[model samples]
Target: MDQEKPKSSALSEKSGVEQPEIVSKIAAGHIVALRNKNVAAADLISGILSGNITALSRAITLVESTNPEHLAKANEVINGCLPHANQSIRIGITGVPGVGKSTFIEAFGKHLTGIGKKVAVLAVDPSSTISHGSILGDKTRMEELVKDQNAFIRPSPSGETLGGVARKTRETITLCEAFGFDTIVIETVGVGQSETAVHSMVDFFLLLKISGAGDELQGIKRGIMEMADAIVINKADGDNIKKARLAKTEFNRALHLFPAKKSGWTPKVSTCSAITKDGIDEVWEMISEFLELTKSNHYFGEKRREQNQYWMLETIDERLKNHFYNDKNTIALLEQNKKAVQNNEISPFAAAQILLENYFKFNH
Candidate 1:
């Protein structure tokens, strides 16, 4: 018995994996909560701290949710995760419909995953101009890439914003980064002039286009070209080779006309075929080189800080709008004042003042 006891003690000493105290305690509490199928705020926080992707996704859904209770809990999770955020690269890709943005993204995402990089393809699809429902289904287009274990694809339905801004997308990117995703790609279904929202959020904006058509010069909206940090002519395969070549030249000229978006690093045009997977490496390399150059020149971090400020102001505007719309009395007053002005019963200036007074009275 004594010999057996010493042998057991020796075995325990050899395998002295103490499993760090903090980790064990957190896990023990989380396990109990999860086993009961009730993920509390603490469980969510601990899960996020350990970089559990599922927990992060669930937390984000809560944040994106409209339920008041969920909003409260989600805010807590966001606050807890805030300290661990902002480490990943934010890349925004925008192109008009039929530009092969999804195909290009699938190829690019697969390549990144193959190289041990985790890629999150966060997309904003254009909503119906009237009903405001998301039209382009980016997840359906990036099917193969969605199956990749290392790739996370989130398609955000565009809301009533003038642009297809998800409103929660910037928050989503920070959450993805906190979960250790190194590459964050935001795909905006280029719609009208509103697609400029992508430019304010990313380190670089990539404009994807199909190269073979002579329509290349007219295909991309002028504002997109102006905001683009790089243009990738996609589908450069098969019989499109010659046309792709010509299109590249056309874009090269077009790009030269635009003012430099990022200082010191001129935007370049590249070609790729998402089907054949040609030029994918070149595209990735160009991005890395551009990032290095911009970061070295100190524009990368500067741009991000400016973007952060933009989001703060944007949030303020959103909350103010909500404050107005959510007040039942304000809505009634707005209608009354609008009708009074429309009927000329009250002077336009007087109606405006009444609306403002009512808004402040309700708000204060």
Candidate 2:
């Protein structure tokens, strides 16, 4: 009886038997399709609305992707999520290098999380002139908030974009909103037109400044000043307190020169020490007031509508330019036209017209 004991499956090697293939536990209709990016757009949307961080991050990557397949998928996700967006408060923070934009965001973000508010920081880092690579090293600077469970920091690179904002920032905002982040803070790459770009997409625009950095007016452009909804003087601790106050007064005076805003809200100027965490709450309070005021006036909704239209036109313009430059025939024509124009055989406008005609013809 012991010698005739039934052998285990492995011991019965001589038996001719086939085992059924095992499927993955996680492999569902749409879940499996996610592996190949063939999942229906609604599934991705559902995942995001359910607060799945992985799905949210993946959707953002898709939104920023240049791959054709990912681009289509990204568009699907965006369209699906659009109805759920615009529920978050979007703040655009911009400052020149060394004004502690990173520090301020860190402290501000921590303050928000402390109050049980979910925060998302979209920090844009400057690309290196030599390597053309961005450090995207903001997380190191924002140590506390980076660790907070309610905080999500996404540092992106400013890749040759004139406005100091990433190309996909507006799209990224939508994804963050859908992820249930009630507050969004966008830190711009640099101090110039980046503010303008950020201003277009956000509900509030805050400009950070440092005292005694230079002639305060010279440090920020008049146009930039006009666009700011609030200006905060950072590093206002130790010996810089008096200087910061002076800068605050000077900024207030300059702000008065601009015509009144349509929102009927006067811009605010304050001083904050991000290191000591002083005046951070005051800044948030000001923002909350602005949101309340704008909401009451119905300007908040109107501004978002205007921004949507602006981005739509901007996207179309970008696509048209990309299409013209990416076409091989267009490139060839451009080279030939460059030579002709340099030799004075044809005017620049004439060469442009010829290239445009050919581009449209080929596409059509």
Candidate 3:
């Protein structure tokens, strides 16, 4: 073959002519359009109600933003979308660290999507104090689910919220529901008061347990067990199957001793293997039965109404707290009062009363 002629480079030394001018121009136009696009609250609401995932994600980000303007817009978006929500099943999943929460969620989420159900997972990851940033590593853990087109996974920071949940988790759930996800799963930080906080927001609370030494159950608190609608023992395959079954029995006995739920639905216990994907359908079936019973008895709507009222009050309390604490004068007064109390110059009650009086005086 003849020797190949010298090929010209995209950047020609003869002249400053760009070879990919058209492609570069088109890319620049796209960047300009994206930068200039202003999404309005009404558009966000409409898009969310129409099952637009991008719009839903944007709305959720607004809700999580600490900026005052974003919060106002987020509230507007939420209010507009409220009428179109409440169709999804909100499930809260919690367990101790190493209980395989991510693995279980991956398996469960994939199963739901396989059956043609849209799934949204709101994962709350632990926050790092030094960086004030979240690990947000759940996406890495749930590799398969991350690839599922029908599934949406969002990992939020726990921040200073004692419950191991993002402050705007309920708002995120609302957006997910409006986006037409039929199943919304919230995975909380596996420690602290997360179970109770999750319990208040979700329709069904599923506690994941694993068989360990005789003290396997000791890690979980009694209040959390009482709040669980269903407790599922995980890692039930192979040699662990027998232990999981025994744990299931013990949990069942424990649940029976609690007072009956207001929904008149008794809690149940089951065994599952996220690795083997066994008994996952049975767990979902149990949830469906509970839903049917609650719906028939009208407790389903009743519980939602209660949750709304609870959240409304919570919002008001949080607003008041933020208002008080964000005031510069309030901070100065608090510091002064704290020092006085520490120095034995004033009683804690007196210091608190003075600060409250000052706070109200300025705020009012």
Scored by TM-score, the top model is 3
Instruction: Tell me the spans in candidate 3 whose CA falls farther than 4 Å from its real position.
Output: 1-38, 213-221, 341-345
Question: Runs in model 1 with CA error above 4 Å?
Answer: 1-38, 129-132, 212-215, 219-222, 337-353
Clashes of each: 0, 0, 0
User: Can you list the residue pairs that collide in candidate 1?
Assistant: none
lDDT of 3: 0.88
Candidates ranked by TM-score = 3, 2, 1
- Could you give candidate 2's per-residue lDDT for residues 288-356 as a string of tens digits? 999999999999999999999999998998778877898988988899999999999999999989998
- What's model 2's overall lDDT? 0.88
Candidate 2 has which clashing residue pairs, if any?
none
User: Using lDDT as the measure, what is the rank order of every candidate, best first?
Assistant: 3, 2, 1
RMSD for all candidates, in order, please.
14.4, 11.2, 6.8
TM-score for each candidate, following the candidate numbering: 0.83, 0.86, 0.87
Error of 3 at 176 (Å): 0.9
Question: What lDDT tens digits, residue by residue, belong to model 3 across residues 65-173?
Answer: 8777788789999888777789999999998888999999999999899899999999999988788888799999999999999999999999888677899999988
